[model samples]
Target: MSDAPVRTLLLWCPDWPVLAAEIVDGVPATGPVAVLHANRVVACSERARAEGVRRGLRKREAQGRCPQLTVVDYDPGRDARAFEPVVAAVEELVAGVEVVRPGACALTARGPSRYFGGEEAAAERIVEHVAQACVVESQVGIADGVFAAGLAARTGRIVPPGETPEFLAGLPVEALGRPALADLLRRLGVRSLGDFAALPAGDVLARFGFDGALAHRLAAGRDHRPLAVRQPPADLTVTAEYDEPIDRVDAAAFAARALAEQLHDRLAGHGLACTRLGIEAVTAHGQELHRVWRHDGLLTAAAIADRVRWQLDGWLTGSSRRGGGGPARPTSGIIRLRLVPDGVIAQAGLQAGLWGETGEERERAHRALSRVQGILGPEAVLTAVLGGGRSPADEVRLVPWGDERLPARPGPPPLPVARDTTAAGGGEVADGRAAGRRRGGGSASSGAAGAGRGGAAPPWPGRLPPPAPAVVLPSPLAATVHDADGEPVVVSARLAVSAAPARLTVGTAPPTEIVGWTGPWPVDERWWAPAEARRRARFQVSLADGAALLLAVEAGRWLVEAIYD
Candidate 1:
């Protein structure tokens, strides 16, 4: 919307993956071919295009256009995998290039233009470098802005500054991105860009909104949009296809090493470092071999390759294979190998410590421990902290170190707990303070010993207490028991109010009087169950006999079930 001028470059590759596939693996550059999805067309080869086959056309329609056309599904994953090296190659030529998709990338012309003597030369250098790395032909276009550059790339036409509007005036109105605008133009008898541009801006804005005006701007080639920037060492992956299947361990290792170099180059170009790598090998019959290799620090290309080879060799020697002869082993023939870096962080070199001395030592120790833990089960190592909860069982929770960040427990807050069981008296800390003061000169350990052996005492209000022994019945029961006044009490409904007599019993335990009680807590949970088998209310009560419990009576009998901690 501003009057400021902007510069951009558009790069595109026609049938990029197919072409890259041919160049990299030396496949035949055959006849009319199309990249398809199931039976729909996504992109067409030049031969297919010459025969009038277009993108988004049905496979049958495309075939109708060129009866001899060969169709292949659009494999975006494969395409992206193949294009990694190309992006890396381009990165070597320009500092801030944006990838438009699987194949094309856009780079600002300012830096490259000045360095290479102009936009044209910059584009030429990019194409040349990219072609060499990816082993494929590429096209580049530079213009005033992103829209114009994109348009230029599609047509392989470069437009110099200040000539965009004039150039666009002759294009069809449909080029503006509003199919509806084309219909409108047709209705209004506007056929060309010049005719559309001749209309007043106010009229277009009022009828069509900003999109209509944007179409007008694009048509006029007045591109002023800035390039979107992306920061990296982004995670990088590399995959390679072999001319012949390789089954032998040494040959497979060689292939993996080559792929690693390419991957290493790509990652380095992005200024990224990775700690984990995964290698995948695909067999002739579509069988895939997957291996995950990890390292403590930045992985070198050769090291990654070695790990892949080792894993593949091990698997091939161990697993049984079908067909002629005896035990199966890696053959000398391999078709493809893909290596991917997993543990990616936006940092360079070894990750640093927070401050100075203590931080450095602490971080180093953590890293070492993490490496060891990664090899073992993640659950095998853990840290525990005091959590704010009503019961002792809920007070302390174990958390995985690397994968989890222990959240600050909510509400009444935590009781004091220890970091390690060996610390002081094995007490858990709440916030930064310890729980429960000890009397006299008793050591913290001595106090814990006494507390642990004596079981837990009653907890005060707002404080977490040791777990209580109580049974939760799945359903309510109907039982008669003697009240404090020695009278028969019959149970009905759900939760008993404080005034209700103790009338439920399980096993040989005598019915106890309710010393404390809370809530009917009505539950309609089983509304979806059988109509007659639903509905109940729950109650929490402490008896005069020192038994605290959750009980429910339904369907006539009390069932002793879950012990609420």
Candidate 2:
């Protein structure tokens, strides 16, 4: 909406995670390496990429692509800590350096460009300073706004004044970084920034909401939002010293949760929320480990604890994975751990809803979950989230109860799956709704125990339609499906059914009459991998007793994979 776009400069360090690990662990830069999060590749070195490794590939797949690749779990704190020196170096040249994230930062270009003679010169100076300060590679870009600057930085470009829009017109819509929105645009034939920016602003707002409008502004080479940079307060650090060294992750995490709560309470008293945190630890042998973590928004108590846990997991386990023989285990144990609030912002007070539960109830739930985490470990207490996937299992993502839940990846909507009350082992049958009442007593207990456990995998293209089975067995149960003539039923590779199913026998249960049946829905999984290829046909049948079952035929054998009660 402004007559003149804000002049912004961005500095980005590619593969910062892998580089940070290399810096911290003394790993050579030439070797193929990747940084993983949730067992998926988040970043990889140029060497690794050249070897066919890519972001989002599973760890095994990445390794399969680059057999000698070094894998490291992503540690935001570590990346941030390692980048502080780079930020300090840049600040020496520019007065205000706002870190966009751990690996990137942005600053107003007007002052620096004039001082350094030109925008291109300023960029060169920043890159030189960072490289000399940390021995890491960095790229710089100058454009009309932060969004364009960030994309330009990826290509190390400098857009002349008033040319930002024209410069960005040809780039892919993905430059906006909103995957779902970008995917939608692509499907609508708006594949480039020019295509997107050409649409009516009101129409974009009416259809895509706030996020889409913001992306549209970015594509048009306009600033999406204003920046509010704040200086972190000194002396806002909390530390814990152990009388007896704590060597295990569980113990360290428990201590982290307590400290995190204290830190949050302290910040709340000052009406502040931390946006960036620095975690430091001292091992018994006197080895010091430090890392910084940055968040786009305020960090909650649980989020802080989760970062602490991740940092410890990386430091404690990372040593063993360092090349040239594992670094000697931390001589003794961790003697001290400290958390520093590196960046803070004022947060508006949260008003309780008139009809909704009060803040006290939320706090109580938080405390209960924290206690469980302390007892059973962080992964044991999880919250379920629906994400992009075809099957119920693929759609369900379970993150630690206290941690942030990210948006699901962009993809087609999942087919509706029927909810089975007895799926976990209790629910009504068609003939008698009360049939599961007696079994319902233990259902809650069983469900609680499996709260974070995921459901069926991503929907296989030819998988069964929703109204998914109430219960999916961990392992298929052996069964037999026969035709009315008492002969075994068969489905050919071409998917022709030999005969209609008439009888079903599961495990040691007596054969039951099939009242109805549907499907020979076939799936050919991993057909390209000879060793792992699977060809199967599935059928859903209703038994005379009002029980429903999902049966699969693989290699001429019938197996009961799920039941609907």
lDDT of all predictions, in order shown? 0.60, 0.74
Q: Which ten residues in a row have the lowest lDDT in candidate 1?
A: 431-440
lDDT of 1 by residue, 1-565 (tens): 6644477787787788566546455435467888778678877778888999887799889999899887666677777777777777877778887777877778788899999998888888888887777667778877777776766787777788777667677778776666778988889899888887777878887887988887766666655466675554544778788778876768867776888788877878877766777768777767776655555456667666666666565545434432333324444445778888877544365754456333546546655554444333345467765544333334456866544345345324222432212222222222212113321222222222123222243222223223333343444344443445665433445333323434445456676555443322333333556865444433344455545454443444333323343
Question: What does the lDDT read for residue 390 in candidate 2?
Answer: 29
Prediction RMSDs, each to the true structure: 15.3, 12.0
Model 1 stretches with alpha carbons more than 4 Å out: 17-29, 37-40, 177-180, 232-276, 279-290, 293-340, 343-565
Worst 10 residues of 2 by lDDT: 436-445
What number of clashing residue pairs does each candidate have, in the order they appear? 26, 9
Q: TM-scores, in order shown?
A: 0.47, 0.52
Judge candidate 2 at residue 124 and give its lDDT: 93
